[model samples]
Target: VQLMLVNLASPVGPPFALKTVTPSAFIQNMLQSTEERLNNTTEVNPPRILEWFDMSNTLHQKFSLIHMERPLFQPFPSELVFQNFTPLQTYKLPLILLNNDKVLRHVKLEQQESEDFFVVGPVNSGSKVAPGMSITFTVGFTPKENKDYEGRLICVTERERFEIPVRAIGPRAILDFRDEIFFPICLVKAFTQKTHLLRNIGNSQAKFKLHTQRPFSVKPSFGTLDVGESLQVTVSFHPLTVGDHREDLLLHYHTGEDVFISLCGSCEELDIHLEPECVTLKRTYIGLTNVHTVSLTNSSDTTLQYCWTMWPIQEVEEKNSVLLQEEKEEESKGQRLFECESSSTAAHHYSVQSGALQENGTTINCFYIFVVQKGEIWPNTTAQFSIVFKPEEAKIYQHTVYCDVTGRESNLPLTITGEGLGPELELSYSLMDMNNVFIGDKDQYDVQMSNVGFIEALFRFSVPDTTFGRCFSISPVEGVVPPGASQNVKVTFQSSNLGTFSEDLLLNVNGQPHPHTLTFRGCVIGPTFHFNVFELNFGDVAFGFPATLTCTLFNTSFVPMNFSLRVLGDGSGSQSVSSSSQVSNLSHKNWKGHAARVRPVEFTIIPAAGSVRAMSDVNIKVTLCSNTVKVYRLALVVDVEGGQTLQNLCDPALSSEAVSREGVSFLHSQASIDADSLRITLHLPDKEPHQSNS
Candidate 1:
């Protein structure tokens, strides 16, 4: 029996068919007819779907229809798959189809939600695909809200239809910034701030966090950015040191994205230096002021404000015990001050004077503060100020001045020094006497000078142009005396003229308000008589033995002089007349009987008087005899006859009767007597007592 099976490609019936035929011929005929039918059906069928490709150049097997032998089951209803698409957003993808057909064909794409996606090129709704070529079309997807979307794209050919799965995700949050880096210049210890713009370009809100390094801070560090909105974040830079500084400002998003902003700046220090570094005032007198100037310069790159204050000067206590006690008390209390005592009242030892600018453009005296106003000194500029030192006592003083800015920790130190002087001079004696000085004689008087104050005293001597000036000479005309020391000035009086004179010695002391004066008085006399020895001593004359002694008389006068001599004893009741006495009696015969006679025996004058030339000397011989063991005194009287001229030249007020009785007397009488006595002691021979004792 012969059987026949027919393969039906129709959608309404089974794929296989059966038929009855004759054994060989009929089978051949049936085969021929069936091959012709199959050929016609293959020629009329559309191209089959091969593989799917997306815009990322990746091949997807989810919608591939190449495995026809395997069971045909759809894991997902939609053939197009989007792995990581966000919701509420539009995603663009290129849809490609691998075609293995031998002829060209036309294709059509259809979707339920057509507004959500768009296709580019001429292959949008209907397109033509070449044989053995890929059918590529650009598809765009846009989502309205945050949700997942699923759809199918139906690609239809002439005989068959294919479905592509369409998946879309909603809009996502995105963070952005306007600038990536920032640069700012800031001063040290000053605050500088800048603002940065943060933006959110996405459809959803975004949360961001800001971070920075030390000395760098950010405001609004954490915040939420709305959709299509921008926020300004403030970044502040507070530098602690000078020079270049750098930091990083990072913005962290909730989506694990970070935005970096480079923070850069420089910190400069404002420096103020003083020229000469120190101020020194010259030595000033007590109760006077000395001024000194100091220059201040700004050496930095910006304007600076500076204020100065002087430290109080330390107290310089005197070495006196009373002052030392006061210093101890002050030290115990941890206090320092300059104290000066004047007339039992306490006073400050030193004071400082500074100048200050007022509102009215006038300068006023400021005791302690020195400051320059804001913006007064520019960079590389200089300013000068004066400081006055006034002291109440003499001492070396020093102090330090500190200059500081308004709100900075930097400062400058300047030193100030000065010396104070107090001058005082005193005279030991206000008056000096040269005593009685003869003509052509020199005499000196000492005047002591002392410096009692705290400074050196310079003194000079001056005398008026008078008789005393010509007669007196001062040793130290000008000299200096230190404090607590004394100097002796010799004032000598030497003159050829005879008279009593008075003068004033003037002492000009340095810085003294008045000159010191000393009165000097002296008397100058003419030539007169002088005795070499005022008394003759016959020391140990034995009893009944005679002793002779010689004495000299000088004629200090300028003219020749004749002198007569007489002898007087201690009334021993004995008399002896010399030969020269009779000759003196004959020359003065009118007054011979008026000569008084007294007991003179123990002593006798050999040549009673003689003539002496001017500036010459004469020797007188005297004889003494002591009969008993007793001390004997005898007076030798010499009368000066030619000294009347010199007597008239001397001051009568300086002459007295007592002065006339001794030697060196200028007498006004025709004959003036100068009685000089002599003493003789007879010891009765101690040899006699020694012989008896043996």
Candidate 2:
């Protein structure tokens, strides 16, 4: 006997099973086929839910199905958070997945592609979790940047899927600092501090440290800052030397990275105060002293030894060099100046004329300055001192007095300035031109010297060491002229020579830096004269016969002239040896001779020494005798003693000819004369002539 379970329907059933079934031939056939298919499979058949009972051709069956919840594969923690994760570095934490149902389950973890958080374990494809047991996995977080990261991981099982939130806490350090820092001027061995703000503008806490060298320090060198928080950092500088200082500050981070910052500052010398730091005196006369008082106060705790001295030569020369360069640039726009040799007499004369040196005094470098007090000054005390300005020149004076003190880095400079005043003298006639002046005669000129300054002027007159300069004589060479007054100075010019003369007479006034130059120019002339005959021609005469000729001399000047006539060169064709020389020389008689066998010639003049009256003529007779028949050449030299016979002065055309005629080779004299010698040639040719010498 066989009983078959068919589809049945029941709205309500026992507590163990609640199902609906229906009895049908088709449904029974389908169930039978499904049971056959299930029995043929290798899988274990499901537990028999129905039991059939047999009783003599009758069957009783009971069906029961228990329905229970499916198992869940979930991570132990619902959410995951990774803290203190460094960027580009891997950080790991443990995670667990538990199976809640009483069954063996296979689970897998799936997460979105991310760089910050990831999962690591055997949960990539599948992981087996027994009933009432859990499987472990590794949750890894690697942050690339400094920020918070959020993610989700899916725990997938055959029957269920679970979501787990994942997060990573990334911490970073950021510093906002300037690349360079500068500090104000500070005294040596003093402390100066500067404050700056250090903030962490990141997602988490930051750790940092500040490093520096000697003479520099930082407060709170290493510390931590919270997110969006700021901290004040103070940098202190203490310098031991006086000068500029530079250093670098390093900022180290916990991530093994370093940053550099530059620090710079300057340290000056000790602080010493001087009351009335400058001295300025009123306008005073030269050769007088003006005094000014000042005080020096020490502000430091130590006593300082101080001494007043002139500015060091090195510093002075440096300043002077700059001034000289500026002066040269300014002077380049004007006339050029020439340097003179000090050893030259002209330079010495100029120095004397200008009174470059003080009278009856030796040269001194500190002549214009004098310090009354020097030594040491106690701490927090003031010492009074005096500065005497003795001006030796009548001009502006400027000097820098330096005080050298102990415990000071450099000397203190104090400027002293003053001006020296003197009399101002003006000349009425600066230039004088005496048109014509006769030799051995004096000419007078009067000039008014006025003193326009506030003081008296004591002036002395001098001349240069020149021929024309010596010709001028000033009456009352040295005298005093009061202020707003004028003095008449007599200038007399007397010359013994004849030429154009120009000179600058020096007027040296006391307290004046430079002398006043007065210029005078004139032409010195002499008496004028002329002769009727320039050459005397004598015809051929018999041996031992005498020939005489007459010529007239005219003196057209305003003065008389004393004259003497003589003959040179006897016209003998003979060569003789000079007593001072061994070589033979052609005799004077044969000088420039064109004919041969010229016999000795003699010349005689009547009234050889005489005077010609002014604006009058005088008759002169010349007699010649030849001993041989030959050409004779002689010069009749007429020397005048009182005045010059200026023929060229009256006639401009005769200048060259007169100079050439006066320069004769045969005429020579040792005594200086005012007038040039007149030369008349005596030519006795061999040919006969129509006229004979008178």
Candidate 3:
């Protein structure tokens, strides 16, 4: 008898408050939603099951013992309780929900009425929790169509677990724990914690954390949207006492899961609001205009109380049509813009300041004063400045502005107006080259002056009257040319140090008056001198070969000379001669003492046509213009080629010691030429047939 009807009522707080008629919050929310559907129940083993691992350690696997489930027979509760059955409250037999052992499934039994609590401590703690009581043995079960089912059912009370003041409630809190109560599980955890046709489901945020631990307050609605936005949604549910007026309750908006719908009275009220975001302006004065907006969204999760009214209907169509921009190549001096206007009744203000819209519009935005000058026309870069509103020219009026573009902005309707004015008086000028007028080298050239225009043009700078005092020299000698950036005038020149160092072009960029003339160009700098002709001569020839000499190139330069020529020889048969007349790009040739300009020489003695000249023997040569020192010399005496001598000459052997066959005057050494000293004579005839030496 529910422990003697909770030991005759009389309980209160912290005993886990339950009394309210044994439904104890409906059996503590059905044992915590049946222990969250048995923790996502996952042992599903019916249509087939054998499992048994262990072949690990790469198969011959020794440490064996792998039953991995294969023997689970009903019973599986491990515990469940909702205490506080009255009697001054203090009942708690949930000893952590019958501590284990379950596989149960359809094992029905019935018989209530019987509690007789006699003695124990928690019969509301006033003591006496019945030392013995528990007659209704088994109670119920709803399992028949079992395919895998499982167990656990300990209904204790027989002898009520030891004497006086014990056995607090049925199952006597699991009668002293532990006893062979099978533990196999894996038949999808034996039908989700002991049989119930199993379709287990847990973790819905852990079952909404036990009703968010009972102290409520959450206001969430629905979301997502972005089509020309304009929304307001709110949804909140509360049945224990309403706060944000539960929007007519009846919500199953699962949208699918067996579908559901029924909301239109502006969604049952509660600050609904929806509709009011018309934005589609797509313009094109030459690109960019499609995504106009007015914005005000807040799709919901409970939170919306906006404020802003006025505008249920205000019209004025006609949005886009453009294709203009191209006409600013100079030649249009009719500019005007700078205005301000006003009216009486509640609104009106027209203003103008444009002029640079020409694909052929020719000076617009009338009623002028000085809109925009200096090469003029630039106005509309998407109309960076526009405030047009016209009316008092006779009647009607209305004008508005708060349009900054994407959509969803509320109140808008005040078309256009016209009347009060004020703002104009502009000017511009441009004349550059603060660095383009150059001509220097003692008599100088500096004409760098700038001021690219924007009002302030009045300049002066010249040197023409037959080029002033000859050549150039302009300073402030011709004033006033200002209006837009640029200034610098100094054109000096007087270096008559003549001949080959030139540069008289200082007319590069004179003051500008036609085609922005600030374009000066000229570069002249001279003086590098270091010329040649230290000495070289080619005169004295014919010895059957060898000879060449050249170097009369005096470069009193003004710069300009590049050369190359080298020829040295001592290898008999003589041969070595180079010419551009023997080297002379005239390293600077300014020859004043010789009237410069010497590029024409001749040196021909190229008569060494080979035949090995009897194995060669007769040399003297030198020719250098580049490999330095000595520009030319050749005395390659490779003679004996004309009319032959001694049949081609061959007599030159001197090995003393084999020179006497009988002589008288000692001291004979002959055969020389350029080693000087000659006078030879000897005659012998008398081989006993006439011998005579004289």
Candidate 4:
């Protein structure tokens, strides 16, 4: 028999060379193959080693080359590398063996004893492979530790034994997650969700299964993650009752690794409290807005949304109409619904309107009650807002307001009550007439101020800016009057100067649109008085003798008059008397008579100073005593406190007289008497005692 050997070391050497081999050796190889096939236990027994010689005659060794065929059985993958896998997790891969020769052959696959790697299908017993055909076998790898694993898969045939390298990597399974997750306070029957990253930070694949108890759940409970891969995991907390909730999310991996994530959450019921259930506003004036503030507090852990429900306009109007009808009916029956006397007190007649929501989203027309603010109230916080009440007319307004909140079973009701007052004050007379007023004297008139409105009236008199206003004064300039009651006000007029006075007085009342104007008209005049005679004469008086005369003073006015009499040239006399008599003496110069003698004259007037009664008169007696008997002139003047003065006029012609032993020289007269003043004349005694100049 001949054998062929190929040289692999020498490039230029012969590719194949025939070699001489003993027939016994060839026959021995055939017999050994037959025995191996008959026993079918080559997997248990190791293959026999054969020695051969190469083309260079160098000694070498090869395994199982029985038939000497060129390309016996070949495996397509000369080496097998398993995918990276987790510990204790089975991973499988396919290995294909092909028959490359033109003959049929029996093939078997075997692997070295390794606890982590193994091969399947006809390991001990062989299978037949046709020429140019292939056979596939599944190789599984199971790693026991976290490390790289290598093994050999041997493909045994009748002609040769081929070795295919197999390798596998043991991977670590690591899942990255937060150790604890806390959820915020939530309302009962509501759910809250939290998202976290589930990442595989290891060098191999990771498979996990998540589990949790009640009130806690996770999305993507079980999943597979590749190396360095991550996914979002959502954890939800849904509570059925109000309380604190605690749970653990268990993440179980196929590699026997477990992780626990703590979940904490709480739930609470909705509660919102109102500070004041009823609101009572003070008495408000008509056409004025009064505000009252109220508070809404949130007592729960969650924020609450709240809004005030306004009373429906139609409903309010209907209620007001009904109340009006009732009032009318009561009036018809002679029974007053709201007593005017009670209006100033605590009793009130109000129409209560129920709170309701508008279905059509119409604008709220709250004519009486208005809400200033509405919105959300935070947890453990209080919200205060204004409730304004403005009345258009005098009446009582009562309303119920509802506050609708998120968590309350029913709407909160707030009662608001207010009274609108309009003061109706009137004067008894529009004009106060004092037809004639005496100067420097006070005149008073009584006036009535009545309050006819349902509410109490507050009134004040505005001080007038005119000069005449000072002459008039009204008592009780400011006062409060009850409903249906009247107040008496005394108006007095006092003036110093005489003139016609007229003034408009303003009465200002609360809640009145305009001030009440009252007019006062009057005329002021002085007292009237007159003298009966223009002159008092003591003529032809005897030397060292006395002469007497009489004069009358009259008062025609309603007031009394005061009078005084004095003789000119007297040491004590009035200023007007002295002034007038001095001028008269000068004018009556009569140089022809005054050079005769320088004698003093004296005059005495009875009742010199006295008051004359109204519409009456008083008589005055004037007596003159002269030593030289020269003509003397004087004036009598009267002065009243608040009336014009009255005086007698003197004639300068008769004012000067000459006294001598012989008959006095005749005195020429020039001055004339006037009607403004009372004049006195003194002369020598005349026969019959001047016949009493009465």
Best by TM-score: 2
Provide the lDDT at 555 for model 4. 65
Local accuracy of candidate 2 as per-residue lDDT tens digits, 1-694: 0111011111212324522222122123223322242222221111111222232343121211213222254344444556544578776655566555565556677777886677777634464667756677778877777566888776665554546777654454566666777988765544567899987755556787776764566777778888778999888776545889998777776755466788899977776756677778888776666777778887877555565545542454455566557656764674433121212122112212322233222223323333332456688888876666666668887766665554444556677788887778999989999987756556789989999987789999998889878888998899999989999999998775678988999999998899999999988765556668677777665444678888887766554555677777654444221222221344434432522444443566887866665677789998775544567766777665533333233343545543222331211242232223356776666755324321
lDDT of 4 by residue, 1-694 (tens): 0100111111221224432222232223223321232232111112222222232332122333334433355443444555444578777765555565566667777678888788777453465777666677878877776676788877666645656777653455566677789999876534678898877766668887777765676777778999778899888776545789998887776865456777999977665557788988888776667778788887766656555565433444466677657866886695742222111110111112333343322222223333432346788888876667776556777777666554553456788888777788878899877787655556788879998876778888865776668877889888999989999988877665567888888998876657899899888766555667666656565643555778777766654444455555653322112223434564434422432444333556788766566678898887765534245555554534333221111122442432111321111111112335444444444334233211
Candidate 1, poorest ten consecutive residues by summed lDDT: 343-352
User: Candidate 2, which segments miss by more than 4 Å at Cα?
Assistant: 1-269, 273-283, 293-295, 299-305, 311-372, 376-384, 454-458, 479-487, 528-694
Q: Which residues of candidate 4, in runs, are more than 4 Å off? A: 1-372, 375-421, 433-436, 462-473, 497-500, 532-544, 556-560, 567-602, 612-618, 626-635, 641-694
Worst 10 residues of 4 by lDDT: 1-10
Please give the CA lDDT of all the candidate structures. 0.54, 0.61, 0.23, 0.59
Cα-based RMSD of candidate 3: 29.3
Model 4, residue 652: what's the lDDT? 22
Question: Which of 1 and 2 is ahead in lDDT?
Answer: 2
Measured on C-alpha atoms, candidate 1 has an lDDT of 0.54
The model with the greater lDDT, 3 or 4, is 4
**What's the C-alpha lDDT at position 203 in model 1?**
58
| Predicted model with the maximum lDDT | 2
